[model samples]
Target chain A: MGRWEPNATDRLVVAALELFETNGYENTTVIGIAERAGLTKSTFFRHFQDKREVLFGRSSLADVLAEGIAKAPADAEPLEAVACALELLAQDVFTPERRDFIARRQAVVATHPELREREALKGLGLIAAMTGALERRGLPALTARVTAELGALALELAYTRWGSASRDFTEVAREALDEVRSAAPAR
Target chain B: MGRWEPNATDRLVVAALELFETNGYENTTVIGIAERAGLTKSTFFRHFQDKREVLFGRSSLADVLAEGIAKAPADAEPLEAVACALELLAQDVFTPERRDFIARRQAVVATHPELREREALKGLGLIAAMTGALERRGLPALTARVTAELGALALELAYTRWGSASRDFTEVAREALDEVRSAAPAR
Candidate 1:
C-alpha cells in the first residue's frame, strides 16, 4: 500500500501558507518558510523561485480545464463546451479535501493588494487559455474570447459559492451556470 | 458660435500620453509632462496626484453606469438592467473625440504590467459600483456580483474591439452584448 508522504514542493507550500497566515505576508521571509518546512534554502529555491510562487504555482486545474475543452465532443455548442470543460476540472481537480488549502491560499492573496493583482493576472491567464482552446475548436476569435470569458466568470462565481463549505464544487458550478443562463435574456 | 478649447486636465492628459509614448512610461517625469503641456508643475499637481493618475484618474463613466442601473425600471431583470446601464454609458460617456484619448490610454496601460494591474483594479471598481447598483435594485448579492462581472467583461471586450478607431463605441458595445447573449445556451 502507498503511504502518504509530502514532497518538497507540498511541504514548502504548506509551510509558506502557515507562516504567511501567522506572521503576515510582508513579515514572512523565504528563510523562515524554508526553515519551517525542514528543508534547506537551496531546496526551496529548487521548488519555487520566490515566496509568491507558493501561491501562484501552476496547478493541474489549468491543465485539466484546457485539456477537457480541447478533447470535448466537436459538435458541442461553444458555451456548453466551455461548461463541460469547467465541470471536468471541478470533478477532477478541485476535490473536497483540497478545500482547506484553496481557502488558505485565497485568504493569503486577499491580504495584500499586490498579491490580489497577481491573482487577477492568474484569472486572466485562465481566460486566455480557455479562449485559445475555443479558438482551436473552430470558434471565431471574438466569439471564442467572449465565450471563454463567460466560462471563466462562471468558474469564479462557483468557486465563491463553494467557499462556504456546504456543498460539492461541481454542484456549485452547475448551479452557477444555471444562474448565469437565467440572468441573461433568452436568445 | 462656440469655440473649442482644451482645458488644463485635458492638456495634461494629452501631454502625459505623448511623453509616455515618446519617452517610455518609466523615464517620463511629471515635470516633463507638465512642461510639454505648457503648464507649471504645481498646476499638474493640482490636477493629478501622480503620473499614473494621468491615465487612471476617475471619470464619470462609473457614476453614470451605476446611476443608470439604479434608475432602471423596477421590473427589469438584473442582467437586462446591467446591459441597459452599459448602453446608457456608451451613449453618454464615450463621445467621438474621447475615443482617441481612451485608445491612447489603453495603449499606454498595455505597455506596462503594473499599469495593467491598475487598469484591472479600475475595472473591478466599475464592477463593484454596478453590483452595488444592482443590490440597490434588490438583486441578491451573488447574483448582482456575477451580473456586474459579466457586464464588465462585455465592456472590456467591446472596448478592446472599439480601439481600432473605426466604429462608434456604442455600436461596438451593442455588438459585444449580442455576442455574449448568443453564446449562452438557449434555455
Candidate 2:
C-alpha cells in the first residue's frame, strides 16, 4: 500500500516492467520477476500464466472501459460515451503517479515482437469492449463498431501524448478524438 | 499445374489449411502439413519457418495492397486507391476457384486464439501498408491513418460477405466500402 499497490499483482507487474526495461523482455524470467518482487515463484505462477502476462496485468481494461461507458449520461451519443470512458481512464488508470512507469512499460513493449502481438490483441479486446458498451447504448452494430475503432484510435494517440503533452490524459484524449473526427476522410 | 498453383508454397498453404481444419490447430504439426502436401519436411521448412507462418505466407497482403495503390490513377482519392487495391485482391487472390478454401481457412482461424492474434497482427500490417500508400499520395499523416482505418474496416466487412454473397469479391468490397462511409459517425 505504501507504494500505491494494494496487492502482490501490482508489485509483480512493477518488478517485471523494471527487469524487462533493464535486462530485456526475452532475458527476464518468471522466477526472476518473483524474486524481484520479494515474492515466491508459486505466487508469481498463481498470479500469471507467463512472463508476457505480467505486462498485461489482471486489471482487465475491458471491464474498466465497459463500466466507464455504462456510467455515461443516458442520452450521450456513441462517441460521447466513448469520451466518458476515456475521461474515466484518465482519472483512474492513467494517473500522474503511474505515468512514468506506463511510459517505460510502453517502451519495453515497443521493442519486443511477442509483446507487440499481445498488445495488438489487447487493443482488439478493448475495441470489442467499447463496441459492446456502445451497442448496449442502442447504436446499430456497424455504427457501434466504427465508433469503437475511432475511440480506440484516439486512445492510442492520447497514450502517446499523455506523458509528453502539458495537458493531462483527458484533455489529450479529447484533442485526439477531435483530430480523428477532422482527419477522417469523407467518402 | 495440377491445380492452380505452379509452386510448392501455394500447395503448402492449401495443405496446411486442410490439416488445420481436419485436426485442431493445436493438434497439427509441420510434419503433418508437409506429409499432407506431399512435400518433404525439409521443403516445408524451406517454405515456412513454422506451422503458424504457413497461414501468413510470403505472399504478403501489405506488398500486394501497396502495389495496387501505387498502380491506381494519380488523381484517385485515398479511398479510391484502397478500392483499386481491394479490386486487385478480387482479381488475383480471392478468385472464384479459391473462395471455398478461403472461407474454410477463415473459419479455422476464427476458432483459434493464436491464429486470431496472428490475424490481428496481420491486420495491423495491412493498415500500416494502407497508411503508407495514402501518405505517398500526399495526404497528411492523421488523414492517411484515419482513411486507412476506414478502408481496413470496410475490407473487414467485405471479407465476411465475399463467400456468402452471390456477387464476386470486387462488387462486395465496393459496397462494403460504401457502407463504411455511410455508417461512419458524423462526429
Candidate 3:
C-alpha cells in the first residue's frame, strides 16, 4: 500500500495558487510550485499534468455532480434533478476552505485571457456532464441540454455571490436557481 | 469614397472554409485562401486580420443584436427584449448562405480544440452584449446576466437544430426560447 499523503493534491493547488498570485501564472513553474508545497516535482506531476492543470484540473468535480444528479429522486423533473445535483455539489465538494481557494483562483483567471478560456471550457464540461445525466433520466434531448446549461449558470452566480461574503453556499445557490426559474416567461 | 469591392468579405469567408476543410485549419494559410478566392493577399488582410479571424470574427453581429434589443418596446421584459434581439439577428445577420458557411465553420471548429476555445469566447462576448443591453433596460444586475446567458444558449440550440435541415432561423430560435421558458420548474 502507498504511504498516506493526505491532501496532497489540495496542498499542490494551494501552493500553485499562492505562487500564481505572487509571481503571475506565466512566471510560476511546476518545480517552483512543488518546492513551495514541500513536495517533489514527480509528485506534482502525479497530481497534475502541469502548472495550469494545477489551477484548472479537477476531474472529481464532474464525477461528484453527475453522481448527485443520478441519485436524485426518480420522479424529479429535469430542472429539479439539476438543482439537487448542484446543491449536493455545493454541500459535498465545495467546503468553506475550498471556496476561499476557488475565489482566489477566479481572481487569477480573470487576469489572463487563456486562463479565462480554460475556465469557460471547464464550465462547459460541467454542463455537458449534467446534460448527459439528465438524458439518461429520459428527458428530451433539448430539455436536458438547456436545464444543464441553466444549472451551470446558477452555480456561477451562486459562487460569485458566495465569494463576496460569508453566506452559506447552499442558500446562495438556491437563490440563483430561483432567480432563473422565476425569470421564465409564462407558458 | 473608395472603389466598390462588393462581396469581397463573403468571398474570403467561403474560400477560407473550403480551404480549412480541404487542407485542415493548421495547414491552411492566408495566401492559399486569397488565391483560392481569386483575390489579392492585401484584400484578405483588408477584411480579416488573420486566417483564424476569417472563421471566428464578426463584430457586426453583436451590434445588430444590441441595436435590436435597444429598440424593443419600453414595456418589454428583459427576457422578451432578448428574444426580440435574437430574432433580429437571425433575420439580419444569418441569411441562408451565411448559415451554410457557419455550419462548415462549426464543423471545422469541432475538429480543433483551439478553435473551440475561440468559439466559446465569441459566445461569451455575445452573452456579455446581451447582458449589457438588458441592464440598460433596467433589469437588476444578476437578472440581466442570467437572462443574457439563456439567450445565448437558446441561439446555440436553435443554430444546432437549423444546421441539420432547412428551417427558419427565427422560428427555431423562438422555439428554443419557448422550450426553456416552459421547462422552468414551478415556483
Candidate 4:
C-alpha cells in the first residue's frame, strides 16, 4: 500500500510562510527557506523559481478549474460552468485543512506591494484560464470572457473570506457568486 | 502668448518606448532612456520610480476616470457612470494625438513579462477606482464591484483596439461597453 511521503515543495512552502511572517518577506531568502525546510538551495530552486513563487504553487489551480469547467453539464449556462469550477476549487483546492496556509499566504501578500502585484497578475492568468476553458465548451467568446471576469471577482471575494468566514469556503463561494450574478444585469 | 515647451515625463516615455522596442527591455536602462530623451538620469528618476513606471505614466488615468464618474448625471445607471468616465478618458487620456505613443507602449508591454505584470496590476487599480466612484454615486457595493469588473474588461478591450480601429477610441470604448453590456444579463 502507498504511504504518505514528504513533498519537497510543500516543505518549502511551509518554511517560506513561517519565515516570511516572522522575518518579514523582504528579509527572507531562498537559501534560508531551503535550510529551514531541511533541503539545499538547489532543491529549493528546483521546486520554485524564487521565494515569491512558493506561495503560488505553480499552475495547478488553473488546471483544476479548467478540468472542472469542461466537465460541467452540457445545459449549464455560462456562469453555471464557472460555478461548477469554483465548487471544485472549494472542495479540492481550498480544503478545510489548508485554510490556515491559505490565510497566512493572503496576509503575507497583503502587506507586501510586490507580492500583491504578483498576486494580481496571477489573478489575470486565472481569468484567462477560465475564459479559455469556457470557450472550449462552445460558449461564445464574449460570453466566456464576461462569465470568467465575473467568476474571477467571485473567486477573489471567496479567497479573501475563506480565511475567516463562519461558513465553509464552498458556501462563501456560492454566496459570492450569487452576489456577483445579482449585480450583473440581463441582456 | 505662450509657446510649447518640452515635458520631461513625456520625453522619457517616448525614449523608453523606443529603447524598449529597439534595444529590448532588459538591455535598456534609466541612463540610456534619459540620454535618448536628452535628459539626465536624475531627471528620469524624478519622473518615474523605474523604467516600468515610465510606460505606465502617473496615476492620472485613475484620477481622471474617478472625476469623470463623479460628474456623471445623477440618474445614470452604474454601468452608465462607468461609460461616462470611459468617454471622458477617450477624449482626454486616449486622444487621437497620443494614440501612437499609447500603441507603442502597448506593444512594448506585450513583449515584456515584467511590463505585462505591471500593466495587469495597474488594471486592478483602475477597477478599484471605478468601483469606488460607482459606490459614491449610491450604487450598492456589489453592484459597483460587478460593474467595475465588466467595465474594466471593456476598457481593456478598448485600449487594445484603440491603435488600429477604424473608429475613434471613444467610439471603440463605447462599442466595447455595449458588447460587455449585451453579454451581461439583466437583473
Tell me, by DockQ, which candidate is best. Answer: 4
Runs of candidate 1 with Cα error greater than 4 angstroms are A1-6, A40-46, A58-60, B1-9, B34-50, B77-80, B87-92
Task: Report per-candidate DockQ.
Answer: 0.31, 0.61, 0.38, 0.63
Docking class of 2: medium
Q: Candidate 2 has which clashing residue pairs, if any? A: none
lDDT of 3 by residue, A72-172 (tens): 99998777887788778777876776778778988988877778777888888888898898888988876787788778888888878788768778888
Alpha-carbon deviation at A141 in model 4, angstroms: 1.3
Residues A4-28, candidate 4: write the lDDT tens digits: 3378878888899999999999999
Any idea how many clashes model 2 has? Answer: 0
* True lDDT of residue A20, candidate 3: 81
lDDT of 1 by residue, A1-187 (tens): 2233359788889999999899999999899998999887778777788888778884755677788899889998887787788778877867788777788888888898768877777787888889888899999876687677667778888887676667788888877777776654456
The residue-by-residue lDDT of candidate 2 on A1-187, one tens digit each, is 1333358898999899999989999999999998999988888877888999888966677887888899999998778899999989988898888788888888999999989888888998999999999899888888888889998999999998886656788889999999988886674
TM-score of candidate 3 versus the correct structure, residues matched by position: 0.86
Report the C-alpha displacement of residue B64, candidate 4, in angstroms.
0.9
Residue pairs with colliding backbones in model 1 are none
Instruction: Candidate 3: list runs displaced more than 4 Å.
Output: A1-8, A38-46, B1-8, B34-50
Residue-by-residue lDDT tens digits, candidate 1, B11-94: 998899999999899999999998999888888888889989888784766898898898788999876787788778777877
Model 2 Cα lDDT, one tens digit per residue, B5-24:
25789889988888888888
lDDT of each: 0.80, 0.86, 0.81, 0.86
